[model samples]
Target: MTSATRIATLVAALGAAVALGGAAHAAQGEGVSEVSVSGHLPTQVTVPLAGKDRTVVRHEVRLAAGFVCRNAVTNRDLEFSDLNWCSQRSRVRAMRRYDGMVARGMLTAEAPVIVLSAR
Candidate 1:
């Protein structure tokens, strides 16, 4: 095969592999029910000139069928702080925690509203 043809074939194969992998991953969570959870939590963040500060932010938790957050506090209003989930470290941890919950049938879907403790 020509170089161009070989490259195209390889790209197609890779695309197919990725599609299959995604399908498999999605299928693994099929038939699961999720709950709409909302709450707020306190997260520390650094201000440009104000240094470090603690803020209460709103977050949503979309939990899958069988998973649950033992420490999840829901239905709380975002009155404490005016910020959403901020800070890279805190955000990553929150995402990982949410992903873990979803993986174990806990949650899915996230948005900025109310509060859902992802800590």
Candidate 2:
């Protein structure tokens, strides 16, 4: 009820707000719509992202040799005969991409985005 107490409370509230905003901003730096999806993988794989303010739509498909994608940049899927085994660097980059994506609105749920599901 005192003037001093009110001022102190105001200052504390402002600091807390600043801290939260900073944390949220730091979490989402870039608007990563989808993962670059480099490297290699057996079998067929396709990742689809729903529409959002960030981007309309995105589809990254990696199918078997015979499988094919009628379209690459659109709703259509894609297939590659040979896998690109670049290096662990690609994996790291993909992981970063996944993190950035989760930070952004691309991924809403709190789950493992980059799942290295190998058989």
Candidate 3:
């Protein structure tokens, strides 16, 4: 994907993360162990390239609630990572998923790391 497209995607993902994080915070004491997020992950993604666009069908990724690492400074920076979500474990799972997303290019390599604690 082009740099612009990557940045845009990163920004949107972070926006969702922030909103969800707030909700998670509010609902922390409700004994909610798991969360599900859908619609964001698509089977096919249209990526813009040089004067043209291409479509890529990503493999099925199970949805689960996990921690998201976003740029601590700002969302304008295309540097962040997130775990799509899954079974509730703890910080260990969140950290693992965070690294996994970064490896998958779902999050930027240089994005500042801020892992929201599991509630």
Candidate 4:
């Protein structure tokens, strides 16, 4: 094969591999857990992330009910991976708390905003 042809093929293969790698990451990403809050509500709460002492701070939001409220984590970096990882970990921790609340009959239908504070 000509040098130019070989080079073009290599470039195309690399591009395809990169695309597939990204797709795999997207597919492997964590998903939101189901936590039904029928009535129990807190103005603010702190949820510690799994395997880490860091916690996520969640503020009560009127627009989104339950776990859909806005969230932030303590000492979170602005970088892409840092932001995404912190957010994901916070979400997971919140869901776990919600599940516990449900199990313990803490969930209510009042739909009040719960503020989650972390340090």
Against the true structure, what is every candidate's RMSD? Answer: 18.7, 19.5, 25.6, 16.4
Cα-lDDT of candidate 4: 0.46
On residues 4-96, what C-alpha lDDT tens digit does candidate 3 reach at each position? 999999999999999999998989868867777643322221221222111111111112122122221123222333222212333345446
Alpha-carbon runs more than 4 Å astray in model 4: 1-78, 109-119
lDDT of 2: 0.43
Q: How do all the candidates rank in terms of TM-score, highest first?
A: 4, 1, 2, 3
Q: What TM-score does model 4 achieve against the real structure?
A: 0.31
Cα lDDT, model 1, residue 20: 100
Best by TM-score: 4
Compared with the true structure, all predictions reach lDDT values of 0.40, 0.43, 0.39, 0.46
The residue-level lDDT of candidate 1 at 91 comes to 48
TM-score of each: 0.30, 0.26, 0.24, 0.31
